[model samples]
Target: MQEIKATMAGSVWKILFKEGEQVGANEDVVILESMKMEIPIATEKAGTVKEIKVAEGDFVNEGDVIVVVA
Candidate 1:
């Protein structure tokens, strides 16, 4: 399993994949809003999305796990 973590503190703006969906390496899984900028968080591995750890509008800190892929 691989954990996709938030790269910076922000509010989750969108979730790009659903649980059990197949994802490619470096695919954007979530979009986060901070300081009026949108930052896309991507997975480093190609795998099925096993979990979504945050919802839209949820606040997250840097290093927080946002999704799990396996």
Candidate 2:
């Protein structure tokens, strides 16, 4: 299992993938907004999305767990 975390404090603007969705390595999983810029979060490995810890429009802090893949 692998945990994906927010790299910076931001609002979760969109969730690109959902639980049980298959994702490839380096595929973007979420999009966040910070400093008026869009930031995309990507997966480090190919796997199924096991959990999504943050929802769209939710504010997240740096290092907050955003998704779990296994």
Candidate 3:
């Protein structure tokens, strides 16, 4: 399993995919809201989304695991 982490402190803005969904390398999975900016988070490797660790509107700190891929 691989964890996808938040790059910065922020609230989860949106989730583009769901658990068990297929994802491609560098595909945008989540968008975060920080400092009024939208930051799109992508998977580093292609895999199935095993779980979403965070939900939309939830706050997360930098390096917090947001999703699990496998």
Candidate 4:
């Protein structure tokens, strides 16, 4: 299992994958808007996305869980 964390405080801009979607290592899974920029969050390991903890335009803190892969 793996936890995909946010690198900065931001709003979730987009979710590129859905629950149960397969993801590759280093694949971009989420996009966040912070500091007036779109930052992509990449997966560290290949796995199915088990859960998404935030919605579009939802605010998140640095190091917050954005997705769970397993």
TM-score per candidate, chains pooled: 0.98, 0.98, 0.97, 0.97
Q: Model 1: which ten-residue window has the lowest total lDDT?
A: 42-51
lDDT of each residue in 1-70, candidate 1, tens digit only: 9999999999999999999999999999999999999999998989999999999999999999999999
The alpha-carbon deviation from the true structure for residue 66 of candidate 2, after best TM-score superposition, in angstroms, is: 0.5
Candidate 2 clashes between residue pairs 3 or more apart in a chain or in different chains = none
lDDT of each: 0.96, 0.97, 0.96, 0.97
Model 1: residues >4 Å from true position, as ranges?
none
Model 1 residue 34 lDDT? 100
Q: Per-prediction count of colliding residue pairs?
A: 0, 0, 0, 0
What lDDT, from 0 to 1, does candidate 2 have?
0.97
> How well is each residue in 1-70 modelled by candidate 4, as lDDT tens digits?
9999999999999999999999999999999999899999999999999999999999999999999999
Task: For residues 1-70, write the lDDT of model 2, one tens digit per residue.
Answer: 9999999999999999989999999999999999999999999999999999999999999999999999
Off by over 4 Å in 3: none
Superposed Cα deviation of residue 41, candidate 2 (Å) = 0.3
**How many backbone collisions does model 2 have?**
0
Which ten-residue region of model 3 has the weakest summed lDDT? 1-10
Candidate 3 lDDT over residue span 1-70, tens digit each: 7899999999999999999999999999999999999999999999999999998999999999999999
